[model samples]
Target: MTGEPVLLTCDSGGVRTLVLNRPHRRNALDAELWEALRSALVDAGADRSVRALVLTGAGDAFCSGADLPKRPSTAHPLHRMRTLTEVTLLLHELPMPTVAKVTGVAVGAGWNLALGCDLVIAVPEARFSQIFARRGLSPDCGGTWILPRLVGLQQAKRLALLAETIDAGEALSRGLVTWVVAAADVDAFTDDVTARLAAGPPVALAQTKALLNENTDRTLREALAGEARAQAVNFATADAPEAYAAFAEKREARFTGRWAVPTRTEDDA
Candidate 1:
């Protein structure tokens, strides 16, 4: 953490929000910001108090992209790419869910960064674009891989090929964002969503996220088997039994065991 902290960090309730603080630059990612973000993400993942994480930016913009002016000055391109790949993996593999709160432009790698999260909530002012082609560069930060998986191949192609910007409503219509709200409602909507996720059964939520990620790469038979195994493990948890009892008693389930991450019986086999 250097250069005036690189980013802003705030923890409220059980949610940790990392806001990209370089508002003057529209939250452009320089090497320092990337490193600081990775460190912050690691710390948040390790903190048991954090039930969910939010990635946003200061000012109106979520992120414009990687710092374009510094690209030519970067000495180790391959190393930087590797670091970014690790960061993406970390976001995907974190035990807690992540939500990207986008109120303004999210372009190039910035768009990819938001895609890396589990969910995205955007305001009416939000804009998404794949600007690599416009810059005479191919997709970086796994944008090519993640975008198609998100909004399908054709839509991804249209955006990446033309480097066109799409507004929030169009993003929602294209399934690019999980939720869309009015510009003024972005903060409230993000807080509400994060609060709901934080209040969920931590163990189950983690398991569900893992299962969804795993199933994305699994065959039908494998997915069914994996679902059964996951269900069996969930059924054995204390929370599961409590849930059943409460349901039978016609009341909300009071799960006292918080943040109980279930061990995976097997890797993605």
Candidate 2:
């Protein structure tokens, strides 16, 4: 534990997988892993080649939430929470798609972490809980906001107020997880799903994600205006033309996400 990195990173097929590496503690996030996650997310956001991202853990468990034994910071509680807030915002707002691959325990902030991703693929053995009330704390890491949105207020209350651990099947039924795959097939399924997402038109996907995230607050008029702007931006990328051509030719579109808008040259100036 002394020399091993708190987070492990891997890149393959345009996907970046960030593994939470504290398995001995059920991959509970500590100060070091939190900072590492922030750095990794920033790097991924800046690298357009990384079209998809995956968040998982090293051993059996995905995460058991923040490590209670280790006090991560001596600063004020507000300052400490800001670190978590940053990580939450980064994961939620990443331009590319994100997936959470949960195998075992995903509780407290860990469950919220999975919820923050665009999709969650959990194995049959996966267990989830809010676990905040038990810890005498309310939800953090965007749980308070995301839970109600995903499962509705009543169910969200049942989870947060009671902090009951729910199994994978129940989680799926309650909309806590996107899919509950067999433990044997989780790796292959995750790879296939991420690859398919990566192969899609990046510009359109990003815009779509943004649109959905903002939809909750915007009015009908505002939402339509946003979509119009998004479509205009999409047309300025190489993906839109490729999509049209592929549709006409009845072939799969290979989107490159290359910018196609004309640049102002010295002569134009």
The Cα local distance difference test for each model comes to: 0.85, 0.93
**What is the C-alpha local distance difference test score of candidate 2?**
0.93
Model 2 over residues 34-112: C-alpha lDDT tens digits?
A: 9999999999999999999999998999999998845355688988888899999999999999999999999999989
TM-score of each: 0.90, 0.97
Best by TM-score: 2
Per-residue CA lDDT of model 1 for 101-218, tens digit only, reads: 9989999988989988999999887888999998899888778887888888998889899999888889998888999888777788889999888877777788789989888878
Candidate 1, overall lDDT? 0.85
Each candidate's clash count: 0, 0
* Candidate that would win on lDDT: 2
